[model samples]
Target: MSASLICELCPKSCRIPEGEAGDCRVRVNVGGKLRATTYGRPSAVHVDPIEKKPLFHFLPGTGTFSIATAGCNLHCKFCQNWELSQRDGTEMEVRYQADPPKVVAGALQTGCRSIAYTYSDPVVFYEYTFDTARLAREKGLKNVLVTAGYITPGPLRRLCKVVDASNTDLKYFDDGAYRRYSDATLKPVLDALVIQKEEGVWLEVTNLVVPTLNDDMEMIRKMCRWMVKHLGPDTPLHFSRFFPMYKLQNLPPTPVETLLRAREEGLAAGLRYVYVGNLHGGAEENTRCPSCGKDAVRRVGFQVLEMGVRDGRCRSCGGKIAGRWGA
Candidate 1:
């Protein structure tokens, strides 16, 4: 009989028997070797607006070719893309056999400015994302990571070499709330975010305010304060309004007022750029300059209506706005 082994990719450090997979359901132990089974097999691929990655700062008003395999490290109770994230590679109905080269080619053909390793967590599909991002970088395309930030620093540091930007889901400020709702710990995610920042990866943070769970203004204040202290005031913070889904359907959708409140808290805590997401056609969707208080970039949902910034600086006052905004 083959011996069992542990997968040390994520903070979970799941132990898998010879015939079994890790908690992510993609890393399988075969003959005592851990293999990323879905390395080249992607389950979802699309040419999406960079804004749809909810990346308001990096390369706004551009197309991003997004891809994902079928696995995730964290099992968040209110996953919006649960059907895709909460499944293994074998369970996907639309698995694509596209290799790294094919994925990069698709992005170029689609006229995308960047490639997004999103939908599911990229940590679970590390090899695929890393390979594709490397190739994409050589071809002059940027790489974006939409992740939960629940990864080990070693892997995250390596990934930051090829990746250009990230929209890390912060989830909650309280450690107890993180464990209770997401089956994950808090410190690892926080550490991952700091590593990304230190690696020169353009970082943006998103918080999905679940009603009565993590929507407390005090917790939001703490999260913003932490970001300002560690990630700097220029780091963009997105407050997302959660809709009832997956295992947390018993909870009501987050009120718009609550999202607005969270945004205010983040800004009040000294964050330079704060946005309210998942709600369209609002003033909070615009990127306001911290120095001049001008709307640096205006957007309605995924559509960019105006660009008031040039060369990553505010046009009105020439204040430095943080992002990768050039060709």
Candidate 2:
């Protein structure tokens, strides 16, 4: 009999017997080897504005070819894409049979400046993302990851090589909230953020303010302060409004006022860029220069209305904007 294989991509480290899968459901132990079953078989693909990734600072107005396979390492109760992320590829109804080369070709065909491994956590489809990112980089396309940041350090470091930018969901400040709501811990995510920053991946943070879950004002302030101290004040922090979804349907949608308050806390904590997302038509969506208070970038729902940045600096104040502005 073959010995059990342990999947170490994430912190779960689930030991699986042959022919069975790990906690993520997509990684299978086959013939004594752990294999990513969803590799090269993405279930979701779309062309999205780079801003829709909520990646305000990285290549602001460009389109990103987004892709995601089935399965996610963490099971968050409020997962917006649970239908895809919570299931295996076999369980999913739609699986696009596109290999790394095909994916790169498609991105080129679509005129996307970057390829985003998003909709679900890219860490679950590590091998696929790595291969696609490598190919994309060779083709002069950048790579972006929209993730929960629940990856182990070693794998994350390897991933950082090809990933040019990322929007990591810092779900909450409390470990208890992580354990109860997401069936995961907080420390690894925090560690992953630090590692991504150290690796020089343009990092942005998103916090979904779920009502009665992670909406404590003090906790939000603490999270912002931590971001400023560790990841630096220039790290763009997006405060996303949470709507009832998946298992957290009992909760109401986060009020706009709540998102505003979170933005206030983030800005007050010295975060240079604080955005309110998932809610539309507001001043919070615009990127204002921290030095001169001029609107550096104006947007209304993923559409760039104006650009006031010149050579990665605010045109008015000449303050350096902390992002990859080069096309």
Candidate 3:
């Protein structure tokens, strides 16, 4: 009998016996080797606006070639993309046979300013993301990661080399809340965020404020304070309104008041850039200059209506904005 091998990609450290898949469902143990079965076969592929990734500060007013394979390391109870993220390799209805080279070509052909490893956590498709990102970078296309930030340090530090920017979800400050809500712990995610920042990746943070779960003002304050001290105050922080999703359908949608308060908490805690997401048609969607308090970038629901930034600085006051405003 073959011995079980450990998958060291994520904090889960799943032990898989031969012929069986790991906790993510897509990675399988075959012939004593762990294989990413979904690699080179993206189940979901699309050309989406960069703002849709909610990466407001990075490459605004541009499209991104987005791709995701089946399965995610963490099984979040309130996962919005559960269908795409909670399945196995074979369970996907449509798997595009686009290899790493083809994915890079598609980005160029589609006029995408960047390639986004998104929807499902890209950590599960590590090899595919790294390969595609390396090729995309050579072709002058930026690479973005929309992740939950639950990855191991060694692999994450390596992945950051090719990745240009990331919007990592900091789900909860409380470890117990992470376990109950996402079946994951908090420390690894925090570590991953720090690693990404330390690796010089343009990092943005998203906090999905679920009512009665991770919406405590005190906890939000702690997270914001940590971000300011550890990740720097200029880091963009997004407080997103959460709707009842997947296993959390019984829970009511997050009140707009909560999201607003969370944004306030983030900004008050020395964070230079704070925005509210998921709720539409508000000033929070715009990026304001920290010094002049003038509008830097204006948006209306994924559409870039106006840009008050010039040469990566606020045109109104010439204040430096922390974003990769493409030249």
Error of 3 at 187 (Å): 0.5
* Candidate with the greatest lDDT versus the true structure: 2
TM-score per candidate: 0.98, 0.99, 0.98
lDDT of 3 at 293: 92
Q: Which stretches of candidate 1 lie over 4 Å from their true place?
A: none
Alpha-carbon error at 64 in model 1, in Å?
Answer: 0.5
Candidate 3 per-residue lDDT, tens place, 1-327, comes to 888999999999999999999899988899999999999999999999998888988889999999999999999999999999999979888999999999999999999999999999999999999999999999999999999999899999999999999999999999999998798999999999999999999999999999889999999999999999999998999888888899999999899888888889988999988988888899999998988998888888889899999889899888898888984
The 0-to-1 C-alpha lDDT of every candidate, in the order given, reads: 0.92, 0.94, 0.93
Judge candidate 1 at residue 293 and give its lDDT: 88
- Error of model 3, residue 120, in angstroms: 0.7
Tell me how candidate 1 scores on lDDT: 0.92
Clashes of each: 0, 0, 0
Model 2 CA lDDT for position 245: 96
Residue-wise lDDT of candidate 1 within 261-293, one digit each (tens)?
888898889998899989989999999987898
- RMSD in angstroms, candidate 3? 0.9
Clashing pairs in 3: none
Residue-level error in angstroms, candidate 3, position 10: 0.6
